[model samples]
Target: MSFISSPVDWTTWTPVIPATLMFIVKDGRILLIEKKRGLGAGKINGPGGKIDAGETPLESVMRETQEELCVLPINPRKLGELWFSMGDIPDILCHVYRADDFTGTPTETEEAVPLWYSLQSIPYQRMWEDDIHWLPLLLEDKTFLGKFVFEGDSMQWSHVETGVAW
Candidate 1:
């Protein structure tokens, strides 16, 4: 079988926007949000959103968690990064994080409904298709960097690099 390659020059293509995704863990359970609106709506995902101008990825994750889950993530650690692309679509550069501690209560918000699931039972089928490829590595405490090209929600190509977190 022949392989299909993206037309864009990934080596030089820059992400048009920066985003964040933070998964908070406690007692082997992970915190997830069922998005109520906007992109990836109705799907289960970590609490995070756009990295505002002049804000670091860490700040963006913290702000998004507070806005979407009503809690302050504590001791968040960098897990990895995911670079996404689609033909003619804007690119998204996402920084993924993991937090084992937090302050305040996690509650339902206008943006999402907070829920927890066993780490072993993450609902991958209900998340973006690319998640299954890299989430497992993160759960295993391995840091990773990955890139994916997609046509809508369907993944067309992907590459990942795994290593121990520094």
Candidate 2:
């Protein structure tokens, strides 16, 4: 199938503002999930989802983690953001967060299978392509924001910055 390019007039493509939560550890370990269904189905991702109206990015992250993994995240720090765009398609404003400590054990929901992996050995093959770009910074204890262009599941290019601290 022919792909739709970005820069398409704002008349098409729905807006996708997704928020993600990554629980980080000192040894480079991170919390991840195996998708149970939809879109990025079957791939691994941090616990997160669409940000609802009236909820801050942090609130969304916390809610999503609780809903998706049955865990209560503690003090989620806003590490960075990603403005995903391609051609003139649409925009997915993603705000990323990190919180290694939390309450409760990770459990599966209808959305994902909770799991963890060492930072040095994250299963990148099972995650969205863009994750490999900025995940390292977060694991390094540095906060940053990133811009990425993706075609379905592959990244075309990326631009990032160590954004101001929150």
* Top candidate (lDDT): 1
Taking the tens digit of each residue's C-alpha lDDT, what string does model 1 give over 1-166?
0156655577897999899999988999999999999889999999999999999999999999999999999999998999888665689999999988899999999999998999989999999988988898878878998888888888888878798353
Scored against the true structure, residue 165 in model 1 reaches a CA lDDT of 57
Give the lDDT of residue 86 in candidate 1.
65
Report the poorest 10 consecutive residues by lDDT, candidate 1.
1-10
Clashing residue pairs, candidate 1?
Answer: none
The total of clashing pairs for model 2 equals 8
Write model 2 residue lDDT over 1-166, tens digit each, in one string.
1144433333453446565565546345678899888658899988887788889888888888898899987777888876776544457877788886888888999998988887778998888888777888877767886666677776766667785476
Which clashing pairs does model 2 show? 6-86, 6-87, 6-88, 6-89, 7-87, 7-88, 8-88, 28-119
lDDT of 1 at 158: 84
Q: Each model's C-alpha lDDT?
A: 0.89, 0.75
Q: Which portions of model 2 show Cα errors greater than 4 Å? A: 1-18, 26-28, 86-89
| lDDT for model 1 | 0.89
